[model samples]
Target chain A: MESFTIVSGTAAAIPLPNIDTDVIMPKQFLKGIDRSGLGEGAFHDLRFDAGGRERPDFILNRPGWRDAAFLVVGPNFGCGSSREHAVWGLKQRGVRALLGTSFAGIFFDNCARNGLLALTLDPATADALMEVAAGPEPARLTVDLTGCSIATADGRRWSFTIDAGRREALLHGRDHIATTLTRTGAIADFEAGHRMRTPWLP
Target chain B: MPSPEPLFPHAPDRQGPRTLYDKLLDAHTVCSLDGEERLLYVDLHVMNEYTSPQAFTGLREAGRRPWRPSAQLAVVDHVNPTAPQRTEDVADESAAGQIRYLRRNCADFGIELIDLMDPRQGIEHVVVPDLGLAQPGMTILCGDSHTTTYGAFGALGYGIGTSEVEHVLATQTVVHRRLAPMRVILDGIAGDGVGAKDLIMAVIASLGADGAAGHAVEFAGAAIRALGMEGRMTVCNMAVECGARVALIAPDAITADYVRSRPRAPSGADWERATALWARFHSDEDAHFLREVRFDAAAVRPLVTWGTSPDQAVAVDGTVPDPGTEIDPTRRRAMVRALEYMGLAPGTPVRDIAIDHAFIGSCTNARIEDLRAVAGVAKGRRVAPGVRGMIVPGSGAVRRQAEAEGIDRVLIAAGFEWRQPGCSMCLAMNDDVLPDGARCASSTNRNFEGRQGRGARTHLMSPALVAASAIAGRLCDPRDLP
Candidate 1:
């Protein structure tokens, strides 16, 4: 995983609330066994029409926002499905973070583990940033995880809060599996005690 | 979505009356790490074809094997066909490749798999509980969000992502952050025509989509205790639609009886010991909760979603909602979009909404009891002209049992297709997809955009309501039949 410290780029605004994983990465894209080339499949239905032609009206397909690194999304974004493919496709398409008022439980965890910053903001503050991102001129924003704040080119800033553990892991690019493996002795000891108490467990 | 400050923060000493969620976390804890995050042992980890291929690939790339192969189980459901006749060969090459990769990886790691040809094969959530793999006082995890279904049996179960899947495969434990507890009390008996699906749908509609976010919800009270295992499973399964990470029901005689009757359950002395331990898995009378909500079950009616999200639902007798009445700007716009997508006019009766398809199957409501309910509504009734109705059982066991009870014949005679077991038309990963612009009355969990197919519209209801709607060629409540 890539460490996420600070990033600055164009921010696209998708203000539709509850844009679920099915919409982010449709079922057709999930057939792939590996994680490569998923950028084309990210938001396939929204970005392209039935004939596979790009829809000119979509924000991500418009000029100046085609390569947005941040998404200013609506409340309860990514609210369905536990498919990590949604996160992978977003990262592949060059999105490094999502700013929303709230997010679904599973999708938020997926973003944390995969190094995509899923920031939760108060509704008023999120709405303010959303306005800037959706403006006619292409909006540019900078996210500084070290300072826990998001800033625009005009020097306006909004501070965010994140779980201390998740913030530490994102800053260091930690591998959770490797970290858990080092506690093998503690796990085995716990298992021994647990099994003795409930002998019927498989 | 964070819970309100708890009365007992951490409860480190394990003193005082504790919630079922707190007890489960303490029983499974391996070690306390960072604040609120601990290494918790997973007694069972379920996997399906779609979300797990990448995890297995990651494990191989790292040259690591499963720490405890026996703790995991895999099945093929999401990307398989559900035609009348079952076959080992998948039609789509990419889907077939995924199944093949899963088979190879499970074999390499020494984990057990319920393969396509196995009679026990079904949706992971459906099959695991049917086989008695989900028991009280157990901590279960799966790569699919519906793993909350196992909490129907008093188990501590929730969903995880593929990265967590890799971690669980390499180590039989995953990090956990304790969720604030919420108890949903259901009082009074639900009248005729009201079922578990309707009750849950009503709850979701009232609470909104993210109502239970960041909370571990437990269903309790008189009406909940009266429901059988299948009803309980239906309620717990859709709790995820309301953003609950875990949904639990305390263990009782019904749970004990169901677990004991399963093939894989312990017998005789071992059973006695197991039941004794499970008796203590419920919350103490004075257990603390961050929140509590009560509902009158008698007020519930058969529910059908009018919009893309599960929360945008109303009773079967209700009319379409006008976005102009909504106060929130974002929510009002969402309602307008949903109404346009559904092709429904404001104030129109839901019964006037005609459907092209009626699907009766999913992990949510495809058990034997559910099929029996559908059969009761379909027997001696004919499906309306131009309506295509189908019933895919949850597992082979459920299909066979329904067949022996002559439920299949009744449904088939009524013009409904009796198909093989898989998650058909639920997520539409298989060939059982609805065409563009087609409307469906489905007994499934989600009503998201393009859930059944691109440009397809879905109205989610119970199995009985689905059958009643199929016969009427519209969204009709079961009580309105004949």
Candidate 2:
């Protein structure tokens, strides 16, 4: 995980809504959990045809979008399954940020946990960003987490919202477990009392 | 898409009055951070192959063992080939590797591994609780979102990501954040043909897919209390489908009875002590819900989903919705897209739609009670021509129990394939899958696009609904059948 303050990259768009995690990375590709080498499996069906050939029409396969640093997707993005392989795939594929109207809460958390930024914007603003992505040349937008704003190549800027805790976590590249460990004493105290009341629980 | 309904509509918002979730979370809290998040102590951790391999590997990299091997359980499901005859022949080499990895890793770590052929092996969600590993007033974590399934026993369980998985494996605890509690009260008695599936589907229909996001819903009232343990499990299983991470039903006699016979359950004096503690697990009378929604169980009918989202459902006899009637533009577009994907015409009776496959199994609705419902409908009937029907049990134990009760014979005689239990065709991770353009009536929880197979369509319904529809080779209401 890298401390994310401001990131600049060309954006690609997968305009389909309700893009579930299964679609992002199918169950077949989830066989291993190491998180490496999963980019090949991201969007497996949509990215590949029955013959295992790349679909020329896929946004990721299209020229100019080959190295997408960010994704401009539709609403309810990453909607199904708690599979974090979706995040691993996107991160491994070099996607640093996800710009969407909204996201499945679990998917959003998974992104933040892995040092990938997930920012929510109103559809209209996302539409503005998509326009920049679809412009004559591939567009690169500079997203500043500290400033909570996205600046397009065309000089237009749209603000976004992120909680303070998440912004700090992303900026510091903090693993959630480390933060949770700070309160181990409190956790132990509660567990000791809980064990007394229900002596049979393992 | 957050629903327009206010979450705190039940009463004026207040502070200091703890909810069921708050109480449970506070009880398990390690330390509160900024009053917004807290570290949580997880009692039970369950894992499946698809999402857990990375965490186990991470443990090996760090030279760490699971904090408490006795507290963690692993099961090989998801990609398991369900055909009892072909259990040894895994067609997909990669999926076979996944199952093998899970077995090898579980052994290396000293955790309980219920392997594919293990009679105890089944869907992790179903088998863990079935064995009484999930108990009341405990906080449970799993790599699968449907971990909320154990909330039926009054557990504070929810899904977790793989990173959280490695964290829990190393340190027995994870972080918890702000969560609001909502209660869905089922009032009045359900009419004939209406079951737990219908009740849950109706709730989703009322609250949209994201309606329960960021909240925990507690099912209560007479209708919920009246349901058997199996029915309660069915309702809680789909709680995640509505965007809820957690669902609960306070422990009662039914829950106690269900746990009593399981192999891991406490006995005699221990049981008495456990029951006494469970009785105190309810929310304080003064507790305030962030939201409260009520559904009259009597108004529910055998239900079916017609669109990609679970909320896109209606009564069995209802009609496909016209997108024009949806006031929200985004919702209207979603509806139009769903109708197009489903190849359904608006205003067409849902009962008239046809299905190519009828699948009866998933952790959601694959219990013995559900099998009995399928048997009840298929006893003297054959699957309609052109329709393929299959029933996969949730676990090998369930399959054996069904066979012992002769339930498998009734289904097999009625043209339904009877097979060992695993999550078959639910997410289509194995050999049993629908082809592109095929339409299926399923007893699974999700109906998201491409959920069953690439370009395949899924319609969510109860096991009984799936059985009746299979007999008719299309979507037909059981009430309309003999």
True-structure Cα RMSD, model 2: 5.2
Models 1 onward score TM values of 0.98, 0.93
Report, to 2 decimal places, the DockQ of model 1: 0.83
Number of the top candidate by lDDT? 1
Which ten-residue region of model 1 chain B has the weakest summed lDDT?
B4-13
lDDT of 2 by residue, B177-275 (tens): 767789999999998888999999999888878788888889998899989988898888898877787899888888888898789998889988878
The fnat score for candidate 2 comes to: 0.51
Scored against the true structure, residue B379 in model 1 reaches a CA lDDT of 89
Candidate 1 positional error at B466, Å: 0.4
| Ten-residue region with minimum lDDT total, candidate 2 chain B | B5-14
Per-residue lDDT tens digits of candidate 1, residues B1-482?
99954332234768879888888888888888999898899998898898899999899899998888988899988888989989887989999998998899889888899999999988888899889888998999999998899889999999999999999998999899988899999999998988899989988998889899999999998889989999999999999999999999999999998898687787788898789788888999999999999999998888999999999998889999999999999999899989988989999999999998999999999999899999999989999999999999999889999999999999999999999898879999888889889999999999988999988999999999999999999999877899
Candidate 1 chain A TM-score vs. reference chain A: 0.98
In model 1, where do residues sit more than 4 Å from their true spots? B1-12
